[model samples]
Target: MKQSQSHDGSNAQIGAPIPSWKVLIADSQPDQHDAVGRCLASLRHDGRGVECLSAFSAREATALFGQHPDIAVVLMDVGLDGPAAVQRLIEHMDKATATWAGPGLRPRVVLCTRDPDQWPERAAFEATAIDGYVVTAPMATDRLYGAVLSGIRLHASMIAQDSSQKGMARVMVSTAGIFELRSSHHFYFNLLLQINSLFNIVQDSLLFVVGDSAPKDDVARIRAASGRFSALRNQTIAAIEDPRIVSAVREVFQNGRTVQTNEHFAFAIKTRYEVMAVAFIDGALGLSAMERQMIEIFRTKATTAFSNMMLIDELNASQKAAVFALARVAEYKKNLIQGHHKRIERLVSETAREMLQRSFHPEELDEDLVAKVGVASVLADIGMMVVPDQVMHSTRVLDGDSVELIRQHTIVGWEILRDAATMLRGRSILAIAAEVALSHHERMDGSGYPYRLVGDAIPISGRIVSVVDVFDALISDREHREAWTVDAALSWVTEESGRLFDPLVVKAFRTVVARIREAEPDWLATEIASPALAGKITTAKRDLRRMIDRITHLLN
Candidate 1:
């Protein structure tokens, strides 16, 4: 599968397009001739795609190299002319000093081999003018394209950098020339303007200074751009409000490179901004070599302007984390097993990764989300801290007040998160987990707590975590109830899908549960036999009792 796509930072430049470059191939074997010829010909014959020139032998290759200075690449067969042909070819290349020696002529030579191991002069051949090597038998077209593109891009960058350096050197030597300085400034501004134009700024597009200490108006403009972009597109910008993205962008600036995120960040210059405007921006925008180079240039020119803003933000996040930890600590005093947050986070993080890959949803989950899910999972049960020990630990029949107190925990979790904006950013996944914690008790038939968000109204993430939370709770015991059999719990959950849970999320949850059971059947079996199960089964008994009660109540 060709699952790879090429990307570089900076939108595609709308400069005068360089003319298509030609390729040359040198090989002696007639049997090997057709395949190589056909592939090169295919690229060229694809209509203004590429131009190819072929040579039958090393001698012919040298002649062609001399004849066509415009040829961009030469694919040379290492074992072509004879048993010693590959070595001979290397000698010729060495004599000519052709390795990165084509000045003004950007010809990349890649050694093509049937078997790199079998090649007699493999090391010598590799050490010569070859920019790269491509294995020939059953050649993968995608790999071939990748190799070719990589070589070409490298060659282009080298040439481009050299040209820029030479121009700068000339300007430095003639520093007294006003016209040279003026031309250089104009060149830079023009480059920026042209690149901006290539981004195809629509009505929602607003320019913002992207460095750390950039003007306040710059940050405001970006926020405004995000709002306009989201409203025009009618999409939620929660990702923009995510803090990880801001961290990622800071990483890019610190390293002087382009940072990309699908999580909604219109853009941030600093590390502190908790909420960015939510918009799904393509990551390819910031992954290109050109984008990295351009950003490096930008950072060099505006260091102080970007740094001041980001440093302040870093300090703010540190302070916020400290306060949030303190609050969680105070709440934990009432109910222990504070480790539930960490455990749940790990479980959900793993499960979400599986589900994201298995399904075709547009969740755009990456490593960042997975890490956040783990952290948020721990905090999911933080709300349980709000409930009194009597209600949480009771084995006797519970009264309405106790049930309500337990129910309010979810709402409390949400409220707590809303107040901590920094946690809100790094732990956006926590918000989803918080929502799930708040409503995990809800039934599919609009019987859930707080908002009773029915059907799709409950975010997919909430539903996913809800199922996992319930599963973990079910297999574990609580003071109020006994744990249920895994089979019984799965059956009940599956039966209640759509009415009590998301049908798809439920199915995915089941898959995850099944996998875990397969990987460690003894853990499930032991938990089923003894609720204590090494003191980790805190909620198992209560869960089993609740399951029995719910099932019996439903049957009645």
Candidate 2:
């Protein structure tokens, strides 16, 4: 006997064939098969009824179990064959189901017998992986129905668990892929997008960074969003129009737990660096238990990934700070003014930004590259630390040997930075700094020192820093020459555009100088006394003092 079922229940079309769970009855007696079939004919679980399959002997039962691996329940008669035959059939079924159906889909087995003394419940359960037992003499219809129903329910639960595990595995793989993205904004956005996709939910989701560390505002702020909440990205909690959503997010953050209702679901994820909240709008209301479990697993993985990303960010910031401090030490040893490196940093940053805006070296220019070159500009003359103090501070004209000794600073600086780069595993900022240290003295016409890298052979970072470093030096007072007027310095740079500088770089430098003049008409006249320059000078002094104190403490 077969029974059919439909997902739509009574609303399903009449007479249309629907899927059903398969229940196999293995018994030598035809009457016993009929009786068991009649007992389960009207039974249903999870909107699906059972279909009965019969096998008359142990051999036939093994074959049937193999053929219908999807069968959810098996009613085995212990007396159909001898006890040894029954044991062999059970073994065959176990092996077949494990091989053909996999972990969660193996059918439940209910052993039936007329002799309860021979096959005691404890012994039957201890011997085989049977789910239930029934006595055929009494043949209670309710007991048979209950056994079949329980088997079907257990099978459904296992399948759901198996599916959830697979879903989570895929989510983990995708999470790893997204972590490869460099930008935090893109990382969070794709994370929310993946969560929505995994559950086949509407893309209405929002991820918020909670606690006082959030940028722009200290309170919770939306860092990533999709669907109708897209415009709310980077906005504070007050920007969300839905009061319920706001409340739920606050609850999660305050309690550090998950909150779920019919209309929304929100959870808090705490990392070593910050607290975060992920909320799904309306889409999470109707998810199954398996889906909820999967979401929990995804939440844990995302927290770990987010925490690691934060740690990387912190490490990068620390590296940049260390690089700047090293450059400052060289500056102090050279006895340069407190703000000289800071001014070079500003000029290089402005020139690089201008070059980027003009689309110079489009293949190589980006915001990250611009920032790196700017920070690296301070290290251009780090090799000056190797110059003899007498030659470095000479008031009179230097002879050829003195000049040669000073020029060796470039190579020395390059080696210092190159070794540092190696120590850092070739980090890009250090690599760029090494390039600047090596080639800042190289002129466009191959007349410069070190390698004399001519024209485009010079790394763009080196080229930009070369022009700015020379301009800064030319306009600053030195023991050998009085400070040149801004006009004189500009005239020299413009005249040497192609001969000594990359013409494109000189053009961008000119724009940068123009912007500087427009912003501070008395910039050179005020020199280090200008308000903006003074602020930077004070900060440099403080940082230098802190570095000196740290070194002194270490020595002590």
- lDDT of each prediction vs. the true structure? 0.52, 0.76
Off by over 4 Å in 1: 1-67, 70-339, 363-368, 422-434, 523-556
Candidate 1, 1-58: lDDT as tens digits: 0111112123232222235556667776665555654554434211224555667877
Tens digit per residue, CA lDDT, model 2, 202-240: 757898886425243448878889888889898888898
Q: Let me know the TM-score candidate 2 reaches against the reference structure.
A: 0.60
Total colliding residue pairs, candidate 1 = 36
Candidate RMSDs in Å, in order, are: 23.3, 9.3
- The candidate that wins on TM-score is 2
